[model samples]
Target: MEKLTAIIPVFNEQDTIERAIVSVLFADEILIVDSFSTDLTLSIAEKYDVKIIQRDYEYSASQKNWAIPQASNNWILILDADEVIGSSLREEIQSILNKKSTKTGYWIYRNNHFMNQAIKYSGWQNDKVVRLFQRDLCRYEDKRVHAEIITSGDLGFLNSKIDHFTYKSLRQYVEKLNRYAALQAIDYDKITDKITAYHLLLKPLWRFLKHFIIQKGYKDGVAGTVICFLQAYAVVMRYANLYLLRKKN
Candidate 1:
């Protein structure tokens, strides 16, 4: 029988970490990569029979890249703290590992939820990530935000979807966007010639329209409207932060 290792990268996810761990218990080994959390996260994680490794905070790609080689099994399942694997998905993963062929990685689609409601649209309907892969055949692309895995061999798609509880509150969502914006600002500064009104105003408008109207976010009603606005706000913050970074330097 082929064994699989589940790697969960977390930081201060005290509320959701336990649930995440419980969902992946089917795996032969569970590895928790902590970002030196100053909360009950570690204490809660200690309750489980899992191997824990603490490392300093960095971007997502770098953190996962560092932890990939540490997994005990040749196959790795990367899971986020707020994600839960349902029975169907769990069974599907197990079935694949038991008789996998030449595929190096698998793309898993996420069923994103916001404020406890499953979002059906808002440009998030197609959200997916490559979480299951061969340890030696895959690595994350070097990116500060929204990095994808670069696989050395052929990739396959999974039929089962993950339940991703994205954000519980407005404050939490805003804080997350702020953090992402700060990271994105560094990349924006390198490519942007000048911070203009178009970047601060028009780009955000387009983002909102693209999501809310073009992407059929209106179908999701209130959640869709809010998400689209937040997406636009994120764009504004990215450029604003970039402008500030340039001014400082």
Candidate 2:
């Protein structure tokens, strides 16, 4: 059998830290890479038998990259503070570790929940992420938002899924959306020069249409409608921020 290490990166996640740690207790080692959280997050983590490391966070990809090599095992499972590993997923991970697998990484699907409700659509239905991977064979892209894994070997998919409590309330969602938009704007400013009306208007409208109509966000009811609209709004905010950056420079 191969040893597995679970690495969870968090910041001010006192509310969900314990649950996240408990879910990944199946791993041989649990590593909590905290971003010097000024809350009870570290206190809650101390209660567990996991190794805790603190660092000043820059971006998600950089944080995970810095933490990955510190793992005691080659097989690594990365989890977010708000995500829970389901029982079936736990068993699946164990089963995979038991076998002689050829793949270097596996993409797991996420069952995203918003406002305490499972979002069946809203372009989040097929939410998959490469969380389980060989530490030596994979690294995340250097992106401020939506960083993807770059695997050296072949990748596979898992049957089990991770339960992600993405947002507990509308306020939380908006807060995160704003933060992400800011980061996205900074990222965009590197490659983009002119932010025009097309970016602020047409792009956001297309985003809403793609999610609500093409992706069938309406199937998820009110939560879906709100999510789709807010996603488009986030697009507008990102472009607007970029426009502001352009104006300043």
| Candidate 2 structure quality by residue, lDDT tens digits, 68-96 | 99999989999999999989999999999
Q: What Cα-based lDDT does every candidate model obtain? A: 0.93, 0.93
Q: Give the per-residue lDDT digits (tens) of candidate 1, residues 22-89.
A: 99999999999999998999899889999999889789999999999999999999999999999999
> Candidate 1, which segments miss by more than 4 Å at Cα?
none
Q: Indicate the worst ten consecutive residues by lDDT in candidate 2.
A: 240-249
TM-scores, in order shown?
0.97, 0.97
Which residue pairs clash in candidate 2? Answer: none
Residue 197 in model 2: shift from native, Å? 1.1
Cα RMSDs, all models: 1.0, 1.1
Model 2 alpha-carbon miss at residue 126, Å:
0.7
